[model samples]
Target: MAYLYNTGYSSGENYAFLEAKGLCSYIPLHGTYKGGPDGFKYHKADDCYTCPQGKVIPFKKVFFEKKNHTKKKEYRALKPVCVDCPIRSACLGKSAQEKKFTVTFYREGYERNNARVNSPRGSYMKGKGQSTVEPVLGTLTQFLGLRKINTIGIDQANKVMHLSAIAYNLKKYLKFTAKTVKSDTKAVCYVILNIKTLITLQIRLLTSS
Candidate 1:
């Protein structure tokens, strides 16, 4: 959901990014048309759509769902367009009528939705970029001695990147272990004034008294 904008690139660009992500799925906007109508179409009514050339592309059918499950959406070009499209040779991989594309959405809704929830605060938060995020990661590699790797292949790369990020966040979190108020805490420290009254009451007198 974070509005990270950039010119769309190839699947190779996606390969690099996918290596550095966890619980994320690719959502391709659209592939290159090799100079056609030069725009796009959105069928909001259906939470599905078509391309600029009127090729109907259904959005992921589920619209919303639990993680790890991908919805398949299909697209097919009109016969007329397919027959007459000058760039059809490059635009449609195979025959235009038989060609279709799929869209996978919401694989990492937990993090992506963070943007939507904060969007009301305006694009200021959105403007903050790698200058802020990457340096923190560097601190992890430098001071925490987490630098270097011993892995090969795309799968290992993806797993390492995800695990590294988790380690960084957990290290940052350790600095606040003495926190007095944290809903994210897994244990109650009521006697030390770090726990809520309701939780304390449950722990002390609920079944005991």
Candidate 2:
């Protein structure tokens, strides 16, 4: 199965989790996600990132980020290497001794999911969802008196939603039946008018003969 979500739920952990469960995710990447620093090239074989100056910043270790509690991989370059570099100020802030950064442990999964999200199929899915699903949600929230479920408990909320769905369906059905009946009535009237004209023509012919 595939799931579609907004950028709010876009994260490396979420992508990894979905892939682990054999599900495809079509969520766009978050705004804060930069993939990696600019002017850096990642070498898969070495498992390292090469800076614009052709310096390799090897992978240091994997650790859990305290704030978000997500697994991340650390990479750092030697202090001596950054000391004399022309772009030292730009690459590393004045307080830092060396160039260091961390990326999500599930970076590979993130890349795969991001690629899928940017593909043609992803665009199609997004359009289909907006056209087919969003309007119903809008109607429910705006016109169907379902802006809020005042009922307490999940069971009650479920019942309310079901009733709302039933009402929408009934409205559609009634409109369709009404149109069908009106068309049938018009067709019958047309046939009767034609028959009356034919009979009047026959009488005129008999009288003239």
Candidate 3:
């Protein structure tokens, strides 16, 4: 199955999981996602990042962030390397330690997903979602009183959603039928007016003769 999601659902781990499950995902990266630091080159085989100053920042360890519980790989350059480097001030910005950074463990999956997101097929899928899915969702949330489900169980929520969809479809059908009837009424009025005009013209002609 294929899934199309917006930037809100974009994540390296999510991409990796979807790929592992043999599902296609077309999701745009969030605005804050930079993938990696600018001017840094990642070496896949070496499992390291090369700084702009040609120094290697090797992978140190994989750890989970306590606050967000995200798994990340830490890379750190040698302390001595940063201490004597000519651009140490510019690179580290008055820091007391070596160059250190953490990247998502699923960086490869992120790269692959990003590549697909920029492809033509992905663009088409995104456009299709905007035209077909997003508007309906907006209507449901904004107009159909589905912004929040007050029910207690999944079944109740599902029923509420079904009722909202039915209401939306019924509204659309009523609008279509209303327009059809309005046009039919105008047509009938137009024909009667023309007949009356013709009869009036005939009466005038006979009286004048």
Using all chains and alpha carbons, the TM-scores for the candidates as numbered come to 0.35, 0.74, 0.79
What global local distance difference test value does model 2 have? 0.80
Q: lDDT of all predictions, in order shown?
A: 0.46, 0.80, 0.79
Could you give candidate 2's per-residue lDDT for residues 79-179 as a string of tens digits? Answer: 88787888888888778988899888888888888888889989988898799777877888888878988988876676676667656654554555556
In model 1, pairs of residues that clash are: none
Q: Give a tens-digit lDDT track for model 1, residues 173-196.
A: 544653645654442332234434
Off by over 4 Å in 1: 1-38, 55-71, 77-81, 84-87, 93-96, 107-123, 126-136, 147-209
Residue 67 of model 1 has an lDDT of 77
Cα displacement (Å) at residue 87, model 2: 0.3
Ranking by TM-score: 3, 2, 1
Better of 1 and 2 by lDDT: 2
Worst 10 residues of 2 by lDDT: 200-209
* TM-score, structure 3 vs. true: 0.79
> Taking the tens digit of each residue's C-alpha lDDT, what string does model 3 give over 88-116?
88788875589988888888887788888
Question: After aligning candidate 1 to the native by TM-score, how far in Å is the CA of 47 from where it should be?
Answer: 4.0
